[model samples]
Target: MFELSRRNFLSQGAAGVSTAMLTSLTRGDAPVSEKKYAVVDEVAFRGQTRRLKLMQGDRYMAALIFPTDYPTHFRLKPELYPVCTPSGVPVTDTHQYCFIHHQSIMTGHGKVHVDGTDHAVDFYRQLPYPNTERIDKFHKTHNLFQMGPSGIQKIVKADWKVTDQIQLRLILDWQLRDKESSGGKSVISEQRRYKLFQRGPYTIIDQFTQLSPHSQSLTLKADRHSLMGVRVNDLIDPDDGGMMHDSEKRKNPDGNYWDISGNRKAPRWIDCTGRIGNQTAGIALFSHPNNTRNEFYSRGWGLMILSPTLGHDVRVTKDKPLQFAARFVAHDGALAGKTADELSDEFAAVDYRKMFETEK
Candidate 1:
């Protein structure tokens, strides 16, 4: 059994910085010194998918990757994986033994079309399948990440810009284009925002994606593959030892119920937890207001996502992008000691629009 580390990572850095740099380099009144500053390091991957690691006080906090395959130009999945506890135990799991389709911590899926070809891709998995609704990548979408006052951001030359910054909460903003979707060319644009932060031992991630058709229109067919989610470690999966709770106060006995809620009156959130290492660790997924789809999808054996596009076919043009938004919270720990309603109350208090202006 592994003993969990409860060290406070935010307290380990050097303190007392120059009044000038503090004001010039950080967000709000966060007295950041040289030691507490976050850093990013890019490393090599075996293929086109490059990896970038984020650090604070020089300790590993998270990693982002661009999962791209060359020969097929499909499966261009982007992810933030292996999120760790203060003591360094990876709280999230990937690369599983059973469902093999779970190699992601936070990933996105949408079927893009051009000339009647099916480009609905799932960058999350790398396998041949009966689950054949999978393919990956964009014609010219390049992903990038960097460290700043807003936190870590992912950029794609000019087509995509994502900022994962910290204010009262960590806020993520993404602005991108539908590169080469219409007859093999960039035609549409999308903007997204996410806010995440940690409270006690829980980490909360909230996201919103907006669309603009520019001059051409984009279509999103109703399917079970969309939104960001996680695949829990086997130790905490229902088939192994975990339990799942939904807003209806109902429990899913196991993972076979992945997205069962999507087929019915979906709940507001789902909570899953079990013994991680030697401590009781888990994840609770929350759905917020204004989402396009009324249902949420959840599976046992550790998989959860917000299927905002389920059964709702969408046609996006420059004038009609605000018709939808997929917003959810991925929180670490099973309320630890609080109730789902209490957690929901806390999530409700976050307002990412009140962000700080980046230092010039």
Candidate 2:
């Protein structure tokens, strides 16, 4: 038998690795078009709150940030308007009184108790805007911040990271901090990604929230509200003929979502759809399997809240911070129908870790 020398073994091993890598690269698992680079731009608006818009490719998504010194304490859905279908049909409602608090899509709703506040914070409704007359003037950023609404969460600051150097996906980042939690610290971290497909387009929103008190514990009552929810356009109002469905195949008839009706049954996902002008479009909330709870505090007035309640109270301290992972899909078309099963099934194939990959 012929024996191979150490140098020969090293050189042959390196060659084998190089050859394997070359073969895999040639297999075309990664397309060059998807890796192509592009450019991005930003636009800002100061309404009742400050809003920021990010234009990536042909799609634009925005955010609403509660400003400093606002009597109410919280940042609402930044995606209030211009959330259109792939063909350019609007999916979000602006200025509807039925449920004025349904501010497009939001990340709030719960009676939370911080160390310094005696009242339970209601992030679900606009406590600051009492009547239709007031709300009409409330959506602008230049308006004054007042009190007498529900409990408010102070807005400390907002930070964002966006880039278009790589194609395939539009990567965006946001880190939001709340005013001193009376006696603690609370923050919301979101990483939003948009993928435009030939079939349609969808946004992948990933959030991580931390509630911690500097010297005390924060208590979150089993709430009917979610930290995140979707508010649809008025045209698809249950009164205007819209459909609300859950993954278990439970659905409410058209115009049924116009009231305070919804399911306590925890499903894997929930969705709502309505015809906007000429196009049929909708939004869906996908509760990841890893979420701690799975129920919806949905409303017929075009609000779908993916919050789960324990019918009791739970305490979260710095040591036991609350965490969650979920996704929202926005699409339009007969092919992009609001069927939770089909959507959920299609979602299972998603590699979230890869989709939400950071820009590094």
Task: List, residue by residue over 213-267, the lDDT tens digit for candidate 2.
Answer: 4455667777656566677766564655887776557665222121223533466
lDDT of 2 at 316: 62
The TM-score of predicted model 1 comes to: 0.63
Q: List candidate 2 stretches off by more than 4 Å.
A: 1-49, 62-82, 115-118, 128-201, 253-264, 335-339, 342-360
**Regions of model 1 farther than 4 Å from truth:** 1-37, 45-49, 70-75, 98-101, 113-188, 253-263, 322-333, 336-338, 349-360
Q: What TM-score should be assigned to candidate 2? A: 0.61
Reference-based lDDT, each prediction: 0.47, 0.49
Q: Which candidate comes out best when scored by lDDT?
A: 2
